[model samples]
Target chain A: MTETVIQTRGLTKEFIRDEFHVVALDRVDIDIRKGEFVALMGPSGSGKSTLLHLIAAMDRPTDGEIRVLGQDLRGLSDREVSYWRNSHVGFIFQSFNLIPVLNAIENVELPLKLTTLTKKEQREHAATALKLVGLEERMRHLPRQLSGGQEQRVAIARAIVTDPDLILADEPTGNLDAASADEALNLLAKLNRDYGKTIVMVTHDPHAAGFATRVCHLEKGVLLESLQADGS
Target chain B: MMRISNFLPLVFKNSFRNRRRSILTVASLALSLCLLGLLMAMYEALFYGPDPTPAQAVRLVVRNKVSLAQPMPLSHEQKIRQVPGVEAVMLQQWFGGTYRDARDPNNFFARFAVQPQEVFSIFSEYSLPEAERQAFVRERTACVASRTLADKFGWKTGERITFVGDIFPVTVELKLAGIYDDPNQNEVLYFQWEYLRESLRPVFGGEMDMVSQFILKADSPESVPRISREVDEMFAVTPFQTKTESEQAFVLSFVSFLGNLKLFMLAIGGAVTFTILLVSANTLSMSVRERIREVGIMKTLGFTPGIILGTLLGEASLMSLTGGLIGCAFAWALCAMISSAPIPFAQLRGLALTPLITLICLSIAILIGLGSALLPALNASRRPILDSLGHSG
Candidate 1:
């Protein structure tokens, strides 16, 4: 059996708004194995992104336990948590959250700075990551100088440059056009298949979900069902 | 250990993220610091007058006990000279007069009726050629001008200068016998007290026998305070009582005429510091608030809270340090320029931004930078990553 990379038991998240208690995620239990591409599908405000954040340790669960890569997140200090996330997780956001001031190559080089890598080695690694995302020629351009597709590709390069064990992407193609969205989804699929990266992506588009090995549906903060993708 | 050096480039770039705002902020800091530096220099000048030379350190002045304008009887000079440590004594009087026009501040300088025979003996620091000294002593209708004063009025050794008196009723005339150099007393003209007395004798009916002040020197610096007290006590019961003090103390008493200047400078300095603090805080707050989303993005990229806080503080400090250096350099240049020109006021001649003042200004600037950004940086660092990522800005 492949090792379980992500495990949650009765995971819950709550928010208080204007003196009203709101449950963003309720009693969610899920397990993701190594090298699996899982797509979490839901309408807006359905807590899919909330669950992904919990797994990535970007947000804490209000109740229950979350264990990623055999380490219980609640047991770690904030500093240790940051080190863990940097070493083990790569996150891609919907808006292609590239630092506007940095050029494409510098953006990819951001995470490598946290390591002991020399400047030359960091540059070589970032270049390889960009080439993997098919953005090798656009490395010197600023985000404003790139198209939405190119910008998202640059963000993808930034995520994978660290060689993290798990990739968490939240609506990575929501802002891209049809062609760009297809290209981004294809890249995610290739990273999971060829690179053997365990990826958990949250998206509402069924077309994007079809590229994953397994699909899960979330509604009103509840995980309803999980099923294998027929073609994949 | 996380190295802040890794993020220095990011901090530098972020400092200039909004060029207009950054430039305006730096300009505001620079101007405020410049004004503050000048204020500190003024306080330094007034509170602590010029340092006395070895000659000046042993000299004392005797004036009327009640007020500086009141005259002391000339008879007191003999008793003062008889004191145990007294080396020499000279009769000195302020001759308030107009040269060309008293209305012009540029024409202002210290004009004194002094005992020419005894002046050099008492103020031994003044330097004059032996021939000029002989000429000055021989000719009773002769005066000596300081090198600075002669250069100001373009006066030569043989030129005759007349003073239209304001205190006495007669005009006095004298020839410039020589120019003397006294670095500590730059703007002054000293003439024979006997000539002034003769000019005033007809109006006062006699030798105008009262002196404005008597300047005396003690044999040693250590005995100056004792001699001052002894002189004042010797004339304690006389109708024209005397108040004696060292030259430095006399200069300080003159500065005290400006009211409680130390307290005033302190209040102004406090107000300026607070104002700059507020301005800096507002600027950093705005800059951080606008970058909330970006901070969250970095947090998501696994930057710790400490790193975030440090980076922002580093940016603020860099900006403020730049402003501080420019402001201090500007103040130093201004002081140098003013020192080159003639300062109408004697006490303000040596105004400058000392090294201590520069260090203090730079320290305040850095404190303002760090103090202003602390709260905003703390809040941004501690804010939840989810909310930061969800933020539109």
Candidate 2:
């Protein structure tokens, strides 16, 4: 039962643009168990990312309820949401968005900066995270100095630096080549298996999606399929 | 907070990022401060009170029947001294001379020839110790000078000082017997009255009787106006009409000219403050624009509206204080250099470091810094986070 780490009841997200309403999510209802690794699959216009954003508390749903890790997110202030994000949730963006000025260790240390963590501890954590991504030797390298896969690995290192319970990755491999995608996915899979982290990913590639234990699809703004994992 | 300590250096780095603009701003501030300080020092020089008027019981100035430029007779001193409140009478005459160094002329104050014994008594800025006074009166070749004139020629006690005489036409060589300073009366660089009297006994050219006004002292303040009236009445029958007034009133008349100069300086000070305000505001605006996204990031990172606003303003104030300090230091340094230069009016004393002046000047800088920062900082605070995250657009 794992206490259902995420539960949404008839959740919806709608954006109003120039007198027309764009429904980005429609009547989404799901229960994702604790420690589960799930993939949300759809093309660009699908509701995958919107659902991911709602569950991550990055934005509020237009209607209905979302309970993430047993806490209803609608009542959280932006500050509380930021606090929750820093302490409880992790995000890996598709672009591997690393601040260009900060070196790999600093980028990994970004989330911890808002905490009362001592400087030495923050460095230790960032170094350990970078080492997990096998880029410890390159901790001092800037983002521009790193190859695309290394930068993506640095981004993953940043995501879990705070030891968040749930890792929400938006197209974690969308920008990487096949090898880098494999590496990013392997890292995510390792975080789930090794650290027992709850993982939810939004991606367009089925090959990338195949790495997850379950797959879900959306058509237009509607969730169309929820299927159990069948093959590698 | 780490933010505040780190934030100031970041603001300073903004100035360095665009060195040209920062230099222009600093230069303008320094120049304005320099000019303001110079004006204040000059005005102080001009209004220096009767610096130690002689304690002589009864002495008076006998000027014209009408105005100051109209000098009165040496004979008028004799008649004025005979009046009830008067004690002793003697004469001194002004010899307005340019310096021997014609390369920089107009370095003129006043030189007077006096009956040496009565000279120190009548005008009394001409003080020598009793022995030196006796020796000075005994020898026509001897003269005494104000401390300022002595220092000007690098002359010490017993050293001979000379000036190219303008009216007398002879290079007057005189001994500096002692240093002089007076908080009242006038500072007169003087030689014997016999020189002007004897020298003029031959020329006898123009107004033979007139001494450039006379210095008169009353037994008390109550008698000043009455003594003044009788002196004017005595000269009324003569050709030169006398306008007698208290010494204080005489010095006060020059205040009108100085007042206009003060008004002009105040206008410049106003402009200085206003210009710095615009410059600092522009600097703040540019700085805020560059960090618009960081503002958004800060907001999203849980910093409050007040935190953003306060940080912006604090940075601005710090900038102003730094600029103010530099400008003030520049003004002080310039004053020191000018004080040491060969300028008579410059040796005119004032503390180059006046707290009120620094406070007011730096106050302008801080005010300008804060005022300029306000709109831009407020604008940055109210901007939507979405717009900020998108930097270029």
Model 1 TM-score relative to the real fold: 0.96
Query: Highest TM-score: which candidate?
Result: 1
Off by over 4 Å in 1: B49-51, B345-347
Q: Write the per-residue lDDT of candidate 1 for residues A1-232, one digit (tens) a residue.
A: 8999999999999999899998989999999999999999999989999999999999888998899999999989888888899899999999999999899999999988788787788899999999999999999999999999999999999999999999999999999999999999999999999999999999999999999999999998999898988743
Clash count, candidate 1: 0
- Which run of 10 residues does model 1 chain B get worst, by summed lDDT? B339-348
Per-residue accuracy of model 2 over B220-298 as CA lDDT, tens digit each: 5567678988888877776777777665556445354345755676687677667767766776688778878766555
lDDT of 1 by residue, B332-385 (tens): 887777766666545566779999999999999999999999999999999999
Worst 10 residues of 2 chain B by lDDT: B1-10
